[model samples]
Target: MKKNQEIKKSLAEILELPKDIVLDIPKITMVGNLQLYIENHKGILEYSNTRIRINTKSGVLRVIGKNLLLKSIVVEEMVIVGEIHQVEFTD
Candidate 1:
């Protein structure tokens, strides 16, 4: 697995490609404190008004804040919008 990752990393660097895409990892983007987008997600593990936990290739992505709403969700991506305060990853 480590060797495969190393190869992928080298390939990404050589081709000027995104590592996240090459490694099949989640890509997270945030805009101020209003919204967040999680790409390449596995699935949503938990959801509530204040928190949302998304499963990914790396780990469980925990989003914490107020008025957390799942604005959109799909097979490969998800969109979260609210007063996002913190984002973390856990095993």
Candidate 2:
């Protein structure tokens, strides 16, 4: 796995491509502290008022906030709206 990641990183640098796009990793976008957009997600692992966990190609994405709501969800992307406090990825 480490070798694969190293290869992908090198490829990304050589090709001048975004690593997330090249490696099929999740792209997370945050809007202020109220909303978040996650692209290239695999699925939702968990959801709740204060927390949400999403599965992606890279790892498990965890969203921590208050009044968390899954505004939209599809196969390729998801939009979360709330008072977002922290976002992290875990293996």
Candidate 3:
């Protein structure tokens, strides 16, 4: 698996493609501490006012914050809005 990932990374670089898309990795975008955009997520594992767990290809993404809300959700992406204190990935 590790070898495959390294090959993918090399191909992405050589092809000048976005690594996240080529390697099937999650793309996380943050706007200060107020909003977050997660692309290429598998699903929402957990959700609450102060915590959220999202499943992705690489791992479980944990978001800890205040007044966290799922602003929007779609097949491939999700928008989160709140006081995002911490974002972590757990394998």
Candidate 4:
């Protein structure tokens, strides 16, 4: 019934996520006081100089740093501006 429908919807969402990141437990990626990339993010909750907050259905997160910039964001993709140091992440 209703519960089954909700479960189905949730499963569909899970299926849509990148397989490698499906269980990766979303994290906040910060680049040297210049930018932040919240992996698997649902949405932004709040913001300030020293902190940026986010709220996901699974959890709430807080990022602490300085000169934080929102360089770029895309569907399943993001880029940050820093010393361009040591690119990491595999698809």
TM-score of candidate 4 versus the correct structure, residues matched by position? 0.46
Question: What is the C-alpha lDDT profile of model 4 across 1-91, one tens digit per residue?
Answer: 6586566567758678543254444555665655556667666666555555555434666555555444676655344443322322322
**Highest TM-score model number:** 3
Per-residue lDDT over 10-53 for candidate 2, one digit per residue giving the tens place of the 0 to 100 score: 99999999988889888989999999999999999899999899
**What is candidate 3's lDDT per residue for 1-91, written digit by digit as tens?**
9999999999999999998899998999999999999999999999999999999998999999999999999998999999999999998
In the order shown, what is each candidate's alpha-carbon RMSD?
1.1, 1.2, 1.0, 8.2
Clashing pairs in 4: none
lDDT of 1 at 13: 93
Worst 10-residue lDDT window for candidate 4 reads: 82-91
lDDT of each: 0.93, 0.92, 0.96, 0.53
If both were scored by lDDT, which would come out higher, candidate 1 or candidate 4?
Answer: 1
Per-candidate TM equals 0.91, 0.91, 0.93, 0.46
Which scores greater on lDDT, model 1 or model 2? 1
Window of ten residues with lowest summed lDDT in model 3 = 19-28
Candidate 1: pairs in clash: none
